[model samples]
Target: MVDRRLFDIARWSLMVAVWLLPVLYVFGLMRLLHLENAYHTCTQARFGVPDDRGLPVFGRLDSDVLPPRSVCTWVDGYTLDRVPWFVTPTMFVCLVVAAAASPVVISARRRGVMAGTARRPW
Candidate 1:
């Protein structure tokens, strides 16, 4: 029993968000890559070149998409440094927003179709 106008607005907003999700993901990926590059550069400068064994003194650069992290890890599998807290949370929030909105939008569309009230053609 939702107001028609409000429901339409919400639906449109969710649709818009769905379209924007890729853009959000791309930006998040770019940010993570930038962070990883910076970390590698800094670590290389701080720790000098690789050892006689041809292994990096600063370990490896690693990243994750979900919950988004860019990290420098030590040889012993310990994190040396990570991107700021805000970076990961920003991507996480984007993921959560997409997760929360997609189901509602899909259900509303399905309901509309079931009721023979879908206006726009898919």
Candidate 2:
């Protein structure tokens, strides 16, 4: 039989971790949103060109006069957006913590059930 105190601690830990999952998710989602917004801002601030539709067009226009006497232009707007501090690490930590803690929770639940069954009056 496992120590009751240890069981309690493990059970509580799992509960706390489970509760923390949503908080972690919120933080991660916020971080991602902020990164996306920053990307949008920076993109518009840098290679943003005002198109005929009044939309910010990203990328550079390359004009080549030696290519069969034709002008060519291409839009290049693929880059890694900068995320705020602790976003990536926190995300990873949250994911790992949740994943690791889940098994612990399951074990605790199984133990609790077993303990309950063992104590049955019948």
Candidate 3:
């Protein structure tokens, strides 16, 4: 049997985490976008040439969400550059944790365990 105070503390912590997920995601996405922009700027400065429209004619940028890659690819399918190693993995872990926690929190709320006013059957 779990102590009531301990259980309430755990529930409150989980609630806080679930509430913060959106803010975390937004910040993570902003960081990812910033990194991607930096990658593009660097690639352009290194390999791009100004065409008629004055735009850098560097390689195209590509990205993947699951693995979280922002790659600059050349015309001939060569990889020019990519974002830092740490950002993507950190974001992935956060996303995974948020996904795992949502269901548990939702179930607890639905079962009235999170309300603190309901009695446990057990």
Candidate 4:
């Protein structure tokens, strides 16, 4: 049982590492984009804006203290890539699904419950 638990944990850990690392990284990148203002500007430029920047011209909600046309700029390329719309939230949803599935899979496997008819292995 303990071995099974360890195996389950290890398997899930590898699954998470393989499936989630890039997505999580991308999610983090998206957050950075919003925080650093690079994502906003890129989105703005895509919509045809005059500023040589990435996001829309309107400053973020918190930055309302700045001037109306206050253009936010980031100093690093790490902040330059705009997270595609809805990608971060989607990644979060996937993470949630993965987390929820891990325990269910572990429990089911530990019980040796197979959902479908098995074809005998030679």
TM for candidate 4 is 0.37
lDDT of 2 by residue, 4-108 (tens): 565566566556756765665555454333223333444543456323344444433222221111111224444433233454455556567667656665665
**What lDDT tens digits, residue by residue, belong to model 3 across residues 1-122?**
34445456555655665666555455445434643354455455455632224434455666565455656655455664345566556555656665665666666656566556566569
Give residue 80's error in model 1 in angstroms. Answer: 8.2
lDDT of 1 by residue, 53-115 (tens): 555445566778765566777665666434455655555565666676566666766667434
CA error at residue 2 for candidate 2, angstroms: 1.8
Cα deviation of 88, candidate 4, in Å: 1.4
Order by lDDT, highest first: 1, 3, 4, 2
How big is the positional error of residue 77 in model 3, measured in Å on the Cα after superposition? 11
lDDT of each: 0.58, 0.46, 0.54, 0.47
Candidate 3 stretches greater than 4 Å from native: 1-40, 43-68, 73-82, 120-122
The prediction achieving the highest lDDT against the true structure is 1
Clashing residue pairs in all predictions, respectively, total 0, 0, 0, 5
How does model 4 fare in lDDT? 0.47
- Better structure of 2 and 3 per lDDT: 3
TM-score of each candidate? 0.45, 0.41, 0.43, 0.37
The best candidate in terms of TM-score: 1
Model 3 lowest lDDT segment of ten: 49-58
lDDT of 2 at 24: 51
lDDT tens digits by residue: candidate 4, 23-107: 6655555444333344445445445553555433443322221111223334342222233445556565656766766766666
After superposition, candidate 2 runs with Cα above 4 Å error: 34-122
